[model samples]
Target: MSVTAPRGFRAAGVAAGIKADGARDVAVVINDGPSRAAAAVFTRNRVKAAPVLWSEQVAKGGRVRAVLLNSGGANACTGAPGFADAHTTAERTADALGDSAAEILVCSTGLIGERLPMPELLAGVDTSVAAAARDGGLDAADAIRTTDSVAKISFRRGDGYTVGGMAKGAGMLAPALATMLAVVTTDADLTAEQCDRLLRAATAASFDRIDADGCLSTNDTVVLMASGASGTTPDEEAFAALLAEVCDDLSRQMIADAEGATKSIAIEVVRAADEDDALEAARAVARNNLFKCAMYGEDPNWGRVLAAVGTTSAAFEPDQIDVAINGVWVCRKGGVGEDRSRVDLTGRDVTVTVDLSAGGASATVWTTDLTNEYVHENSAYSS
Candidate 1:
């Protein structure tokens, strides 16, 4: 169970003939809520997708009755017609659930610079809405995959409530937001303000801490909807922690299933001047192509890590920095410590730790190793 694990929510997925193959490409999630409080985070990319632009306004209202998502056309960079398609999708969803268009949120993911198949997509909305049921979350999750090999879903049971979510991403995963689409639902009693604050905090700690290829997506969107069906008002701190755990689980799944990735790497930065400095240093290392390629080749190249960190504006001195690969201190005091050959990178997971020697603050960013297949998959993506 994912989104539908929570009470007052129903979901469904249906094939809409959007993708070349007859795969499920459209999904609908409806909140039959006593309270329809909702909040969302979208890609910060300046070249916004039509669905992102539409959902931003709906999210601003702090309430949503339903969300419709499709996974074959990004509907980005398609000019005015793209916006109209998104608007029509929302309006049709609102009509199905007896609500206003402003109360429906829309999300899309796939190739950019293309228009959505409106006829098929509108028909899909009708079918998905009609088929929505409490156990349809698995289908909904499955419908939102492009290059993903598996559907990402997570759920956590809290005191008298449940938080569940589903997400999809395979490439172009970067900072400010990954190239992804996520929908999270909860049955706990919460206000729109609380939902907004909790969603932002959870994303800052999870989704914002991952980088795959350093390419931001125009269609990235994550939404949190509260139904208030549990009749339990959870402690803000506890709920935020649960939400962060769910988001983190989905984020790791994205990296593990990243397009053509062989190794899941964690860049941990410690002893920075502040949290921001630590994040900056870690993200720089995570996005460095040389560092990623080194990991893919099973080489513990500490110099690449140091060079990447040096490009950051973080407060750190050259001689005081230390680098460790898979628990082996490969570089100490910015010089050589353990033999590079002693560092192991033979597994599917790798960890690179950097000691900034500035303060007590720390952060970790997750990423994947670059490979030849990554280049091949992306080069032929539009084909």
Candidate 2:
């Protein structure tokens, strides 16, 4: 289940000698479309990667016929030559596919500073294009992973259309669109405007709510392409709901396979004065490293949660808040309610619920517990 799971798409991944161990490092995705409408979101980081810069222009036209991605080197902070490399890659891909260079998008991820090996990368692109097939989405997913333990893929079916996607993210996941590269494809009949709205709404409820390490990446990008192959135009509301469902599934997969993570945490904030308040409080708790570390240790340290929530101006009185861990009420009315010892955290999944007692608004943020493995992984990432 991946971007190729939708109609009119083919994908492939190949090893290009960019990674030291000869792992797959290059991927190609092609849309044989009747209508190649598209939309995209990029990292909000000011220091953008070369591919991100190029893709910003490509997506503005709201149509993409092909995408080339690599996982060996992040072409970031490399100045004009880096952008030239991205443009050359797009041109090469277009040449291989008999498409215009302007219809091709490029994406890359890895160490932030080094330039990509152009010769090897260009050769890899040729090989990836040659291998592109309808069943090659899994290989493409594998090819886009760095520091990730698994390839994330998801699928959702509508009345007569289907949405499928692939994602790679395990570290540097933060609120500014998360450090990841994701591609979603659909056979539904939709306009570019619909694609843009659906992508933004889905990402806001999914990727934008996750904070693994609170670090933004220069190469983070998510693209949604519509091929109009299914020949069925769905209701906008139903389309958005299904799109959000696929995004949520992918987000859960990303957290479950997070780098060096032992626990996947869900922080839910309820009873807030407004949706914005609920979202802010949930994000505050999700980004708290102290609370994450405590969660890793299975310590029912509700105080850490309270401290995080208090930092937000979410219109909640200290004495009116409540917290529950794993269905066990540990804090109530800003005081101890149940025995903290009764809360369990033995499983890989943990849920923390906070009640602001202000209103009925609610929100959820997905996060991962902090651990020594995370530190070790990041410490040796470049080596």
Candidate 3:
């Protein structure tokens, strides 16, 4: 389907001399208004990318006019030089947008430990600025991809407002944010604090709950910007609902596109003492490579799920745990309950449910099955 760009946001994409493949590598998203409120979330990992560090600090003020992003090289672990390159990118973008350098957030994704091609990137910035247009959102989305096979984008329209987003990540994904880089734009009138609140809540159930592999990225980031172009402003509750829907759509897309993924798994944990407990249990299973691989082979390995949950402190009695796969009661009271042959998992989407019987809390985590292709893809990734 041909997705439309969000209202009031103009975008541009051009080759930044970063990708040797000759695909567009740099992108900019500009708010055409006088100013806009912004909120952002960054990788929880201490070893963060230079651009993430810069953007995190800039987002503290809750105002941003533009964002600069590049692919093909994650400006990470390069120490001071990487920071300088990131700052230069942001400064150039800000200059083009006629805003302060601090108002331009920056993001980068790709191979780590290499310095960005500054000369080419600087030159490309001008080209991107010149190409800026209202219909360039798709181009910008396409420019930020690395190992992703296809660009991931989504949009939701509300009363006189819209929420649009794009994300990229095919591997090095897990909770605590993944190797993903996402940009969400909205035309709603919202304060920086409100945006932050809505974003955090949305992410907790969406991106924050997905696991492709156990690995995390140094450049993970999710940013939201409000152009305030829409005159209609909804209440906090209404806005939060819409934000959740947008985030859910983006999160599902990310899981479906996981590198070497032939099947997507949704691990639902129910009847936990609280939300955190349910999430902890679900994530434990989501990150289990053995479990994922078994599922990939269409093996009804309920024991692996039990083992994963047992490793967590989620207050679940072993005998009270119930498991279901694709609506088949695979296990009851921690043991096999039904015919394993009845469950079918040849489809691209798979669902597994674990009932803790501890309380009323519940959580769901999305993950992908592990296969030989996954190993092969990462084995020679750096080469």
Which candidate should be chosen as best, given TM-score against the real structure? 1
Quick one: ranking by TM-score, best first? 1, 2, 3
Error of 1 at 80 (Å): 1.2
The residue-by-residue lDDT of candidate 3 on 1-383, one tens digit each, is: 10225567888778877788899899888877533888998888899999998999899989888888888878888999999999999898877777798788999887788888999888878788778888888888888877677788888877777888888886433222237888888888888888888888888778888878868789988888888777667677877877788778888888888878888899999999999999999999999988999988998799999999999999899999999999898999988799989999889888999999999999999999998778767775553
Could you tell me the lDDT of residue 306 within candidate 3? 95
Over 16-49, each residue of candidate 2 has an lDDT whose tens digit, in order, gives: 9888889999998899998899999999999999
Q: State the TM-score for model 3.
A: 0.96
lDDT of each: 0.91, 0.89, 0.83
What's the C-alpha lDDT at position 208 in model 3?
Answer: 89
Error of 1 at 211 (Å): 0.5
Give the clashing pairs for model 2.
none
Error of 3 at 239 (Å): 1.4
Tell me the tens digit of each residue's lDDT in model 1 across 12-59. Answer: 989999989999999999999999999999998899999999999999
Best candidate per lDDT, number?
Answer: 1
The parts of candidate 3 lying over 4 Å away from their true place are 1-4, 171-178
TM-score of 1: 0.98
2 or 3, which is superior by TM-score?
2
